[model samples]
Target chain A: MLYEKKEAWSVLLRLYHWAFALSIVCLVVTGLYVHEPWTSTQLEAVRTFPMAYMRYLHFLAGFVFTAALMVRLYLLIFGNRQEKFWNAAPITPSNIVNFFKTILFYLYIGKKDHRLGHNALAFTIYVVVFLLAVCQIITGFYLLYPESVFWQGWGLKLFGTQQQARFLHHIFMWCFMLFAMIHVYLVVWNENVAPEGMISSIFSGDKFVEKS
Target chain B: MSRNLHLSDLNPTLDRRSFLKACTMAAAALGLSSEMVPQIVEAAASPQRPPVVWLHFQECTGCTEALLRASHPDIGRLILDIISLDYHETVMAAAGRQAETCLHDTITKYDGKFVCVVEGAIPTKDGGIYCKIGGRTALSILKEVAPKAAAIIAIGTCATYGGIQAAAPNPTGAVGVNSIIHDKPIVNISGCPPNPINFLGTVLHFLTFKRLPETDSLGRPLFAYGRKIHDHCERRAHFDEGRFVEKFGDEGHKKGYCLYKVGCKGPETYANCPAVRFNDVGVWPVSVGHGCVGCTEPNFWDTMTPFYERLPSVAIPGDRGVVSSAESAGKTILGVAAAAIGVHAAVGIGRRLGKGSSCCAKPAASTQASDDKSKE
Candidate 1:
């Protein structure tokens, strides 16, 4: 087999992916603490940094996550073809057929369909997850500031009640959690099954794909 | 012809001391200062009773019935005497054309001077044919009555967020008074049957101040619907302690643990129910060992359904079935993922054993290096 090194990801794209991933990690940890503090420590200091600091870090990470998403979306429109969201998506009839074929390959019932970027199914899932991320941002902020003028005036119109918004924020967190689990597993599996160096792609922006 | 007439002398049902006490209590319930009691007493003691037009539409007449059965034994008489109730379908002595005649006459005589109290929801479906008063649809009746009133008070969840009538697949297109009459400064007293004190306080506040009290975005008086029920719940300690009632007859349930696991919407619902208690008996839904249905909230009927579930159920009509609850669905997904990962790992091990050493060694080394890099 002959292998070629392709520039599958730009440095900026890789940076954005890691930044978004790290921020989501921060958010999930802090958000779960905010939801239900499971700490056994009973520090009685006046300047203790317990729940308050967790919340502050969560808010800061939230801003970073939102910024990363915004920048990624902007780059998807204007960046190179490899970085464009549409390159990975390819929602045509052939791509739809390829999506099923890729699924079959995952189940070990079909031949390998190696690519430098995300598969059609993965792209579809990514799109759905991105939409969920958008939902999280909207609902998260609304839940945080239900009493604000902006929330009372416009947020209520966009999302119904604070309860409903909080529900969505929580549901989306689960969605991201679920996605992260599957995504990490699949990436590791792909790397192990086929020496694609999938995990290191985020840091190196390069992958060696074999073509017959 | 004497100018020195006290409220007790005129009413006879309540003595001077009792009347002042009631006034003070009402003022306090309104979240008003002690000084406002004198103003409330003065307003209630005035010679002229403010004419109140009580309109009923698509409703069960619960709000009026609740008021009648208030904690204060003489609350009914006090409310009636304080306000010259021109017309109320459920309580008025007159009926049929005679009652309709009184409503019309009152609307004409005190067009912009009287208070308009609307109970129940207004149906807008089919030209508002769902409810009628004197051959007039609810929409038309409200249109005619609301604009002429000095102030409108939409009492109960029905007249606030269209209540259960406006729930999902709402055939009648029910809506609150605010949706219909946008011109008037309306106050919404939202609950299944809102606390009688809240209604009394709102009325007394209006009577005392000659203006509506400050309201939230939903047009509900801040004094009653300011804090979440969860904040003041008696079982809040249980919630903070992470002790939850998992099921209906479990030890936790019997021991009066937090009902959050059993779908208590109190955390999401904003009302002073826990503080004030229903019927003033120190017993609310939570006190009675049942979760709050969140009836006071907007779209509660649809949004807060599956009353015993922790999270709202996905509404997918017909045979395809529903997505039980958010938490349950999430747990199921997580369980499936865990199982799938376990199976996949087993499969991977089996394949590796069959393939022997050559296929596994290099990939494992590379994957390990990559994992380390990712961690960094």
Candidate 2:
């Protein structure tokens, strides 16, 4: 069978994807440690700085993730037609049907077909993940400065109290964790089964599609 | 204007020097410097003592009891010298029609000049019939008395946020003083029974300045309720070191570890309890072993319940079945992800094996055809 090399992602999209992934990984790891802080303290002389450092890392990654998301949204609005905002909306009848069809294919009940970009179900999940990311950014910043006058001025009053904001941020972190798990597993599975090199396409911006 | 005539003989222990010393101490408690001590003394020693009308409603009268129990300056000094305690149900000597007469007399006599100290939650349901004093409902009495007062001081958790009465399924529909009286400046000295120093500071601040001190968003005076209990707690080092008491009577608990795990609301609660200590014993709740119940926060009885649990269980919106604690919810999501990964791995191996067998047969057939073509 012959194969044709097609551009699957743009350079900016690929860069944003990797940067977002890295920042999310950093945030999740640092955020979890900051929440519970289960680490044993053998370093008694410098015990306070670990939690402080974890907080710093978590906040830095949060800002990075927020900036990447803003850039990704900007690209979605003005980038190629495939990456446009309209593609994110899966409201049409065929898109709805294809969403279920993709689910059925994943459950091994239908024939699989290679698509150019994100399939219907993946696109919908990506949209949800994006919204969750926005929530995480808001809640994370709210907790970061809970004691500041500005937070009490109008910030937390709009969202919630500091504890409630923390709860929401924790929930969003878990959502991102679950999303990453499912997303990575499916991407690897798609690359192995369909052999479109989906995982590499995120990095190289190209996928080998079957030439009919 | 005359200092000798102004000194009260009823309380012999409160002489001129002691009164001035108490004023200095009270001023210092109000976050004022020593320079303001003379002003406080002048305010207290003045012949025109501010009349304070103390109101009792749906409460156990713990606030009045706590105030009377304050030892640093003595309640006699606070009531007789600093301010005229006019009408308190618990402490007033008069009774029945005489007491009712006194309340009305004070209301009419002061008429927007006196301070109104409310000590309980006000019930608004069933025409506010849950609590009645002098044949009038608490709500009716508050509506009658609040507007005519110069300033309103909600002096307990009950008066601040409806306390335990305003918890889940409140039958009386109880609410704090601010809910009913919105026009007046209400200084909320909030706690189960707030530190008497906070009360003293507020009253003295008003007595000296002729105005209330700056308050927080919740109307708690910033001088006393400025910082969270956790910020200055004795076990803060334990919290920073992650040394938490996992259970009651455990080694960590005995060793004075942080009570964060066993539902210490100190991190979320704002109060000066850790700084002042109840009854001047150098011990607060956490110092003794129990965690803070967050009684200072609004609606804490409902919001900060399951007192032994780390975090409250969140109710998911639009879904009645999935009430989950934060820990359980996180575990459930992670468990589902792990199970999904396992299932996906099994399916992937099965699919790969099925494809392997079919592709093996095709490759064998192709080799035979290629061999035939080469031999020809």
Candidate 3:
């Protein structure tokens, strides 16, 4: 048997991945702090603005996350064939068959399968997470600027009230956290079980593959 | 002499100068200029005063009391000169059969020409028997009067969003006026006891414009309910500076710091309480060292409860009898996820060990094989 080293993720895709991950971490931490400030400053009120700083960081991270998502969306449309949305989350018959096979593999009932891009189930979850991120952005802007006529007319009408928007935003943060935990575990497991450099491929942009 | 009489003549308490001052003050409160004062005075002194039919149900009459305490023109002058209060159960000299006759006569005489002011929530459960006036259910009376009136003014949070009566476990199925009467244009003056200035401004806008004022999606006038209390709040600087009252009667409380930590819903409540104040005085809930209870928002009693806490506690549905804040819920879910991941990892390790050392060593062997093959 022969093996080959191949480019799996483009440089831009890897950049987007790390940027998105870092921003998500920053956003989650700052968002929780903004929601409920657990720390207080002993300095003069004029000298310190802990909550404001947390809120500022949260907003900054939110913008970064949005930018990262936009770049990823662009890659999904215009990147290499393997980075395309169809390859990542295709509903083709073969992909669908492999999705169930992958599930069975996870359940320890089937042989392990390797792929160059996201598995069908992982891609499906990514699509859902993408939608959640979009919701979070909309609700975030609504909370940030409640006086905006656009938000007042459209955001409020769609999301109900400010409190409702806040609730959705908070809930979506937890969803991201849940997804992150599982995502990390799955990738770690893949790195250990598969010949591919699953964990390092995201950072190094290359993976080992069996030669045809 | 009677035909040419002025507003001062009708109400002895108001003279020409003070009446002008009141009108000017009202113009300012309504976000109008001094030029609009004459129009306001004209509207107030109009010979054909717009008839108002006041109905109360499922409320404490605090809104009425707040209206009574309004002193820019005073309640006496407001009722006597500004608008013809033909039917109010609390202030009218008539009662029982006489009051009923007055209500019926006013509705008939001014049919489709008067403003119907609803001051409370209407109970709809079991035919709205919870509150009645003269053997007539409040629901029935509202349904009867609201159809004929030109417009409806839902006063107070009770009338705007069912208030406390419509809180969790609402037995009587209390609902706001807008929930019942959807045909007519409704202006919601929403608060525990809405500022009388907001009510007066709405009426003046209607009188000056010959229609109801522009309203938000919630049927609250945009002039008053357009901006959040936090935006116009006096202690907004403190909020920005991260100065908060940690508890009641703390040093921050005495120093008049922000009440964000003390469950002030001012950030969410869209009302001009901070700008307009209450009772013709320059003091609101926040100014007096208390948090805004978000009474102006819809379902405030339910959504903004546990008033001492910053965020509303998420209520678990069904009979689980568990109520937890969103933070706690998030933490709990995270904990469960962590535990599940831990158990899953442990089980995976255990299964690998059970399958003998070959399964565990397979990854390293495969990497070694791939490397050797690549070197071929």
Candidate 4:
């Protein structure tokens, strides 16, 4: 019957969110174009730098994406209680139980589970997505500086060749795209049904919760 | 100094002037400057030619053919003047027992003082029975010769990686020289048939410096394999401009546009072919209108196949029969994910609407009961 407004995300956290999201969007778009250029200029080869420009954009966005991930990783360790990794993704027995409950809630078999931050299932997926981001960064750097002795010894040994690294990078790009789609849909769904202001919280850093 | 035998004396056709020019060209190709020419010339005429024993196995003799076509110094000058090629099956006048004798004599006479140049992949399956010479398996001969040599030179893709023979389902268990000889310093000059200048440069560097040139992790000389082919491509301007050849004989093809769209492997392949060219001619595969096949990379046959396509197919794990490009696989997975989400969302909305209609009166009754209790 009554609700109270509270800060769910810090200003810094919100900034990191949009930066990560926008950078990923730029990376994917430019990365796909670099992978397979779809446009060609009619101007002289010396007059245009279409492919070069695409590659430059992709690399620039990659650095931005990497920086955003670094910030999030720092926050995961040292941020507020709700933003701390263990608090959000704890694997305790009760957390495991609630993880399944969240699944059931998604399936419309149970009432919605209320939380101040990410639900158990969502947090687990975020952890996996973060791991993929790390992999993307490693492979991206390997592709960028293939002649580096460090990468030649370690990255080549891990992925076997530049082609394999490119493949993994491409695969991870799709994974991020998939995650973004599902994440947007779920946030919209929760905003409409759960009265948490889930969508607006990302922008305003506040959400309405039960008074208790 | 006693009148030492000069390089010109051994190869009369290569006069002193041409000999000096060849040396300079070689130094340039090896990423050395004019200052190294005198040292190279001295090494070339030193008369203490380092004996070389060339072995062939599971090969097409293309590397030797490429060597013969080197015109700067010529193969005759190379084998007779620069380095003493004691035993080469393709060029040696000896055969059968005589060839075997030459091989044995060189190994023993120049023991720990000669270079061993392996020209092909070694067959290790079934006791290396797939390839043999004089009834001796290539594996056994290599095991015997590699240990005695000062350094091993793996002089082709076959000897560096496994080449075409080591592609998927490698029936003969083909392996490179490095796979067998780990104790000795091995230099890999990798290519389908490596440029002869690279080989000559490596040998001359050894003769001049009394040691092998610096090599990449793959054992290829850094002078040749340090930068990607794409980095120094003649058609790089086209690549940057996004002007590409779409097909084999299109207008773009005739105009010499970038071959990136037609599956050029230069972007991923490391070599100096664009600069050095091949057969002493100013033309390589790309310069002549074909895309690079990435011949110098390890496992090129498997990793750089479908020569006219840009990217390798993504191998599906646990299912050898299914292979798909990365784009196709990504599109399929994204499609499935979209459909699943659509179904989930539709069912969720339908269930919520059904519950709202059926339970519309229950919440009103409970609110009224709570209000009455609060009044009491």
Candidate 5:
């Protein structure tokens, strides 16, 4: 079947996606620094290297990610409804059955695509991932909300403590990782199974859909 | 500013010497009387006495013993005199059902006025069948008492996060008070049997401020469990100097060197025990020649084992040690994800290849057999 670009994503969307990728890298590296007990080399670098600067980078990235989320929510509400992000998260009985089929077919479990519908697996993963992303946003703010000096006093007025923020951050980190794992698996599966189909979607914003 | 204003407001008719002399005499009388002299003085000074109700469950009662054995001259009694400890299960005269009734009465009378002290874990296994008080599970009692209390203080490791009894395969399905009562503010005063002064200081801090004191990440009272024991330990000097006692009763140990090498969990433990020694005797685990067991930390039973062994890997959380590409941003996420996906895809493609080959071979075999059968 032939496919065309959906033009669902704006230029801003691409920028946000790339920027989010950049920040994820920063979070993981610095997060490691915070979690691991420091060695002598790390201690020396903490004093000497731009290690302290990385924390600022992480904060800046998080700030940008927060802004992207605000924009994303705005787009979701005000923009076109044809894109099917809502479709990615359908709840009808038929959609639920189809979702399972697509997920299974995509993973090469039961069948590839039984009449162009979702397998239960990927649908569940998509819903879980979206919810997890929402959690990521919640927990990310909980971390950033405490340290913010300007409106940060807002956190004191709101959630109460930085330690609570840290708790939320630590808890959601594992969730984010689990989501990332599943996300990469799906991306690779689509790429290998139908390489041309996978590359065009993000690069040119088109997807593999059957001929109507 | 308020203190200065209050001092200036006092009448100038009384001389300083007479005033001072009167204070000393009153202090002496209060010390000797064993009555409500201190409480009377405090009551007259302030309008009301803060009431505290302490309850025990699934504990060694070491915390109570520690509380009673205060540092100086029995401040526990002084504390009682100051704050009306109207109901205490361990130390009160009442017993069994009557004691339970006293707790209920205090809860009813004070309502949201009294502070609640819990010392032990709440069992949740089999609908909390493991522990029973007055024919009801501890979980039920906690659900009943905790919500109504003004402030709940979980006063030991057991009460804070189900210390030992809640370890793996936990028979009781033990949980902390906070785990159950998410609405009320809980102050965790955790230790195996936390230093009594820590407890006193927390209560005093509350009395002084009319609010709970600052706490650490684990909801621990910061003033008591802020710094690591290893940070200010006496043998810390020896550890810094790289002089360690390798074995118990070894030459280095005999010299009173650092006990870190022999499995001291002090580095990870956070408490004020080193500064404020136990038993008011200037002695603690390390002082008497034993290593720290890290009893205060969460999952200590799992994370801190070989009570004598050192941690194997103490690397920073995400500093991927010798990976091909180690970018300091976002942790080691992409590589781990990429590797996992790569392996999954590799196996998937390999299976697809095998499937294609087998399919083709089977078709060729069937066709050849048909041809041979026709010739025969």
Candidate 6:
């Protein structure tokens, strides 16, 4: 009955994917370095080059992270949807059930179960990462408002002086570290349990399933 | 440059009878007791300007060099005019027996009346033989001079904490004048060849008030040593913004970013060099694209090191990529995470052993059992 069913990552989604990942990694590393004496301190352009350049790099990357967020939101709202259990998992109760089951499985509870759609564990990671990213964006904007007013201007006042904003930026960075460790563990665990859970979806936009 | 100190300058040197006669005349002139007039006139009309005996201990004589650079219209002349510079080893014209005689006479005559300005550190090891002036140990010389002085001013880092000589493995046990003279009230003006103005300020304050100015816990004058250099650094904006130069000539270096990343001890050091500046010049160390060496801090020689490296402290707020210390943020989040992990693990293990245990064990269990029937 199906006329045509093609599997592929749309350009906008891929743009969102890489940008989000890069931004998260950047935020985590910089945040950690600032807080603790991690590896002493790596020399940067600020060490050799003029100070303005390092600031530019940090500030400019902030906007890129914001743009990536915007695109992810767009994909959630406007991207084409296929009539498949996997892509449409968000709408199914099975998705919610699988999410918790995955959590229990990770904690080493019961027999492994097959899951389709956004699995239970995946949902939780998704939510936590999304929130932390939002925190980073808010804090980043607060620091950037002296230059960027669109979002950061009000954020600055809400956070108090630039020092308070700075203190928050350092504190909030740990979220990304926690998120990353958990993300890597769960993604690989998912890959092991359901070989094509994330890999197939991001690459081809479709996951293989046994027919009835 | 003049060497000789006159006995006539002090009318008190007049013979006992003449002094008593002068006292009677002065008392009548001033309406005071006859015997008290000479002493009163000496105290009121021309009190002896505090004699400043500049002593060079273990140092480069930088404090002496720096003092010569002072220019406040008439401050240098005022110093020369007011203080009887009986002896300054570096600049005084007297030498050999003449200089020795000068020091002896000043101590013998002025004794408790003159002020002593000791520059550089005093070595205490090896019977204090590491440094000597005129074949006498610096220690013995200092011990001899310190007791008689009314007040003592120890100028420059060399005298504050032995400068770099006391950095590590201090063979000589080089120490400040205070470390050697525990009884005298020592006023320290600490700096690596400290700003001339700080020294002048202390000296003027002493002259005007006839008493030492307020000092901090370390016996440093409060006016200059009260504030941190970082608090007033011109590049403070760069530090607050998390803008820093990583290397010797990177792009940020060209833009003159903060040197905090490059071992700026500004945070830990307390001094006003950044505010008052040096040499009347418009720039300081950090302003010149270098980090503060914290030259003013106590034992900055040993405590602050890797001169071009960041201090092992601080995650400044207001910086774009700043992250706070984990002690507050990391500890709280980590605690939650650890608790969450523990609870989750316990729930999973309990579920494996029992009927229900977890965030949603019972619901997941019923559903999984239902699914098993469907698969069959």
What lDDT does the true structure give each of the candidates?
0.77, 0.76, 0.78, 0.79, 0.62, 0.64
Enumerate the chain B TM-scores of all models: 0.79, 0.78, 0.78, 0.79, 0.70, 0.71
C-alpha RMSD by candidate, in order: 19.3, 18.0, 18.2, 18.3, 23.1, 17.4
Q: Write the per-residue lDDT of candidate 2 for residues B120-220, one digit (tens) a residue.
A: 99999999999998789999999999999999999999999899899989889999999999999899999988887788888888888989989999999
Worst 10 residues of 5 chain A by lDDT: A75-84
Worst 10 residues of 2 chain A by lDDT: A40-49
The DockQ values of the predictions, listed in order, are 0.02, 0.03, 0.04, 0.04, 0.02, 0.03
lDDT of 4 by residue, B1-376 (tens): 1122354346456567666766777799898989889999999878888899999998899898888745444533655577888999998899989899999999999999999999999999999999999999999999999999999999999999989999999999999999999999999999999998898888889989989989999999999898888878999766654467889999889989888778899888999999988877678999999999999999999988889997544211211111112223434544543454355345434544754644564453343323322322
Better of 1 and 5 by lDDT: 1
> Can you tell me which runs of candidate 1 are displaced by over 4 Å?
A1-212, B1-12, B312-376
Give lDDT tens digits, candidate 1, residues A21-75.
Answer: 9989999998998788766267523224365556656765676676667656755
Q: DockQ: which is higher, 5 or 6?
A: 6
Worst 10 residues of 1 chain B by lDDT: B315-324
Cα lDDT of model 4 by residue, A163-185, tens digit: 98899889989999999999999
Give residue A208's error in model 2 in angstroms: 45
B1-376: candidate 5 lDDT, tens digit per residue: 1113245345324343433332333333222243433443443235377888887777778888777754433345445645778777777898878888888888899998888899988889899888887788888888888877888889888899887878887788888788888988789988887776666656655664577778898898776687888767888655533457889999889989778778888877888778767755679899888988887787677778888876454322223211111233323443333343355345434544654644574454343323322322
Per-model i-RMS: 15.7, 16.7, 14.1, 15.8, 18.3, 13.4
lDDT of predicted model 6: 0.64
How big a share of the true inter-chain contacts is recovered in candidate 1? Answer: 0.00
TM-score of 1: 0.53
